[model samples]
Target chain A: MIQVVVNFTERTYNGFMKVKQKLEILADAAKYDASCASSGTEQRNSRNGKGIGSTTGAGICHSYAPDGRCISLLKILLTNFCLFDCVYCVNRVSSNVPRARFSIEEVVQLTLAFYRRNYIEGLFLSSGIIQSPDYTMEQVVEVARILREEHDFRGYIHLKTIPDASPDLLARAGRYADRLSINIELPTAAGLSALAPEKDAGAIRISMAGLRERIDASKDKTASGKCPPRFSPGGQSTQMIVGADASDDRTILTTSADLYGQYRLRRVYYSAFSPIPDASPMLPLQSPPLIREHRLYQADWLMRFYGFEAHEIITSEHGMLALDMDPKTAWAIQNRAMFPVDLNRASKSTLLRVPGLGVRNVQRILTARRVRAVRLDDLVRMHAPVSRMLPFIQLPDYHPGATLDAASLPARLREVPTVPQQLGLFM
Target chain B: MHTVYLEHETDMEGWRYAARQLIRLEVAPQEVSWCVKSAREPGIQGDIFAMPDSRSGSDCSSQEWAISNHAGREVVGISQYHGKTDVTSSTIFPEQLAPSTHADHLMVPRQFIELARSVILHQAPERFYLLYRVLWRLQRERGLMRLAGDADVARLHAMTKSVRRDMHKMKAFVRFREAIVAGQPRYLAWFEPEHHIMAAIAPFFIGRFATMDWTIMSPNMGMNWDGDVLQFLPGGKLEALPAEDDSEVLWLSYYRHIFNPARLKLKAMQKEMPKKYWHNLPEAELIDSMIAEAGTRTQAMLQRAPELPRRKIIGYKRGPQRPDITGGNE
Candidate 1:
């Protein structure tokens, strides 16, 4: 059991600074981790708005982590201060951004304040590799241990792990956190060597593998046959800096698929890299296509939930995902030879391939089709934007065998990126 | 103290409706108490009793007098909920739509409920609302990323409470009940939701009852006239009703199924929907035990062990699969 508080040499460094200045410094530094979920726990106020509780905040934004759970997390870093220079990161030791560190008490205090005020439902906490991996990991575990044992808090918590943390520290973290993520930093081992020279990919994997072992070990039932203390019960997730490496969607997706198959990871977050505030000409001044990030998410979803394989959707000729039309639509246009699949007899997987047919819509069609053949009007009722699917699917009465076109599909759907290459938005 | 806007039914308010019934009970003048607050408050903390403006014949009759004497003038947004309870139930009032307690200082009029029910489902700038909520979810909830060190769950708990401060107006005040008028039964309810949701959600009721003529009353607000124009009213009091109950079972069935299974994370679910709310709603009975025994039940289901369904499986499936209920949410 954790003691109520850790008796640190209580340090109070007050910056007679304005809140906005502090926010500007903190928020700018906090970017990088991505896990925005306000779900998994719901508690309301007792009466008269008298107590501290809320189910009222906007909880969880659905972004795909690699294993493709619409992983939501409170993605922020503990402080921008770093002792190592990892090129892909803005918070690298050499960078000149202003840095601030939150005391564990202050951090805990802020989370509860925000929670009671209905600003958030959970905490996603990550930090720069401070003092040492073991020390930093210990501080992180202490927070979780205290939150659980001291406050009896049952809210969702996701921790961004430090590489090279001790096995004992990781095991303790598993007890309080709902999910733990160890950023791969970049895709290939060569990329890590070139960019973050001090970072070791092997060590990172070893930590992840260690986490997996402890998580597995904790699941061993207690002597009474009850489940032992939980270990990241929400499961493990990781992030990959999208544009930092030469990896394309296919390569990235292939790696993601392998990670999912091997680690049984809950998600893989693809964060499109943004140029650091300071100069580094070795890195591209231009941001990677943010829409590419969006497309990657779509393709990722398809592979995980919609039954599309990696190669079927990504061909060499179409080296990247289509910027204008969705990858699924583009795939349909290219595979016109398979067009006009009969909606009446199509399987759930085939129906999912049809544009405008979401999983929910597919379920509706499957159930409805069993009772009666679906006509275009019934499809309309299903809110299946028939125009999008019409060119691809064959309804009961209409068949468009001649309309399929594999040759012009690519040229018809090229799109220009919308924002600064980072995330497709001008801002 | 909260800023409330009390609404009245053109015909009756919870006050008038209950006054008529209290006229039937005879007892020694016992001081009566009524508690009320925006549905958002905790632990029934906002309850206030009003002693009537004057006593009728006896102590039991002072139910209204007691309520008004306590806090008749202080309550605001005292809108109506349309649900009804059996008269024999111990408390004469429920936070439901029907006014068991006849204190206007505490309860909303039926018309306020009608207006509220009319627009509860109308769409609004949900994204704008969502954007605000997302930020709260981030800084306030998950903490600005605490992986390398300590996390602050308490801070997250505090920030999440303020996000939906306005939703309480709908939950405590929504009044749904069945009533008959001009020889046909109409399912009607009243509420005082802040945003213009009536136009969006009324269709849910309309989709269910395309042929019925019912008015939803929201105080100092508007009401929906069946297939016609919306009716608006200001501050309101009490009235009585000749009522109906034809389609309640279908509504109950629909409510039972709207829950998402994959997202059935109870903490998340409870955070979005509080337990105090269960007392006033009909479906609470189905979920309460499920919530209490949630972990054990979940493990049992996962193990394919013999845990029972929420209710006995008499072999009936429920769905809101009407073909006309076409649109899905964003």
Candidate 2:
């Protein structure tokens, strides 16, 4: 009797600790993925009181980690054990990190529990290749299926797709997921071969192309005017590890631009390569400047929203974005003839190119100019960066004059330090 | 002077009805004042029941008067009403000057209504007065609201923005703790919002957690949803909630492990999740330690010697048969 009681207690204790241990190891393994978006999904609510949760177009960041990333989803992996020997990956087969895997039920329960507590927008499920790519992909999709069908969960779901997974598994993943992503891993094919030898560059492109075609077909009407089944209604996105390869900003942006155009990708996340434990010799010992990642995001935004082409943003002989200034300001300085834009008469596109005018502020300026001439005071009220815009814009009450022609324009407008700041106590 | 009193801070219907009467009476914005009567305030405890007799000439029915009297304990003033036997006689228009019956016909832009709806929830004492002033000006200056450069319009926008942000934050930060109430599971949360946004944000929670029984408590208000209906109740002390849940251990573990020590932008994190909301958040307690140890942890990772490949190379090459690429399963 005593032995049976002891065994029972031990089993329960281990079972409880197993989940906690797996969560820590798996979540730690998955943290390197930078894509945490849970927005732009179809609007849903549990108003019928049948299920639990809602997604109202706009994503909510339930918490912000100390790393400054949005904890919008319960971003976790199915397992941290892998078969591939990716040099940069902490969970690569050869790496010495501790490994753990969660059963599908554990993931489902964790997602629903955390979601009910309003701790996350939804689940972002990714996994390392466990057996075959097909088996791993099936496990990831099964979690989403149970969340959607069994529990009637209507919240946002983002699944990190395995590019080498069978096409049928990819289709099922899209059906259950609001967004699906296949990480491009590196900017260039050479980078992939050097870093992640097992990952095929051609296979990644084929998967992306397949996703694009299905997404397009889902949007189209059939002969009877009936729409096809939903397939990643929020569309596809990808991530590329920055500074892991010798690719320049030009190459990165060029890849992103091509992905955006060719695959109709919703976003291309750029994660600056951060150092990991059990380091590999092939990887860099130090991380790229965090600001480099910030600059890349700004340049990516310029390409997406600000109507600047990738080549136009990075036009220097070194094929690099200015570390001292923003890509927009650098472009403005390089092509000074385009500036001194009239605030009152400038087109929306012209206003968007102004160094200090953001999309919303430009709209505000346009609205205010319709009633009366926009003055310096008006720009200040609109929260436009007056000093930054003084050289590039011509307000009705103010003009650039000699400021635009100053030889030290670049030096004067440089906001960030050219040299990277030392990683201090609190960066 | 027109002294119009509202029931509470977020009394939009009362404000609209009173403002429509004042606008019809041709009262200028400066001639009007707005005030809220809290239960703690002295005077006018008995006057609420007696005032309906003075407005006998007006079209306010006895039933409406009864409803307003029952709900008018927390009163807001449009003009100052001193303690007097006949306060309404001197407070509003004369008995002969009846409010126009066509008050609903008074028109403002749809934009003004949307702006006022958000602005009314602002904690500013003068929010109602500013809204009325804008409405009075809009009667003649039809394009007044469109001029974002105008000071009054800009202030309105700023207040609206603040209230909207407060609402959004309330939604983002209300962390629920599970508790057993009457042998059933119930989720409870505590939040302190900067604005009177409880009623405004109630629908969002209702839509999100419709099937779950949950309650969200603020300092002044509380919301409860029992699977089918949502009810507003008086707020309670934080002691009423569970101190912790077992699941929080897993959540904290996930929070701690997921944070990358290499990139610590405390400012960016603080910008979205400000320190004001730290005490209620269970994971917030880990932030200081996480940040304090970040630099050392990163240095360790960077300085750690690269390990040699230990495992044999498992070259699982793809076979000649490619995976089927046919698009749809159906």
Q: Count the backbone clashes (under 3 Å) in each candidate.
A: 147, 10
Tens-place lDDT digits, model 2, residues A193-255: 889988888888889989998888888887448979789988999999999888999999999
What is the CA-based DockQ of model 2?
Answer: 0.42
My TM-score estimates for the predictions, one after another, are 0.54, 0.90
lDDT of 1 by residue, A217-242 (tens): 56677655776666876678888888
What is every candidate's C-alpha DockQ against the true complex, given to 2 decimals? 0.02, 0.42
What TM-score does each model's chain B reach against the true chain B? 0.32, 0.80
Candidate 2's TM-score on the B chain: 0.80
State each candidate's chain A TM-score. Answer: 0.83, 0.95
Per-residue CA lDDT of candidate 2, range B119-215, in tens?
9888877787788878887877767777777777888989999998998888888999998999999999999898888878988998999999999
Best lDDT goes to which candidate? 2
Off by over 4 Å in 2: A1-12, A417-427, B38-99, B102-107, B321-324, B327-330
Pairs of colliding residues, candidate 2: B4-B78, B33-B78, B33-B79, B34-B77, B34-B78, B35-B76, B35-B77, B36-B75, B36-B76, B37-B75
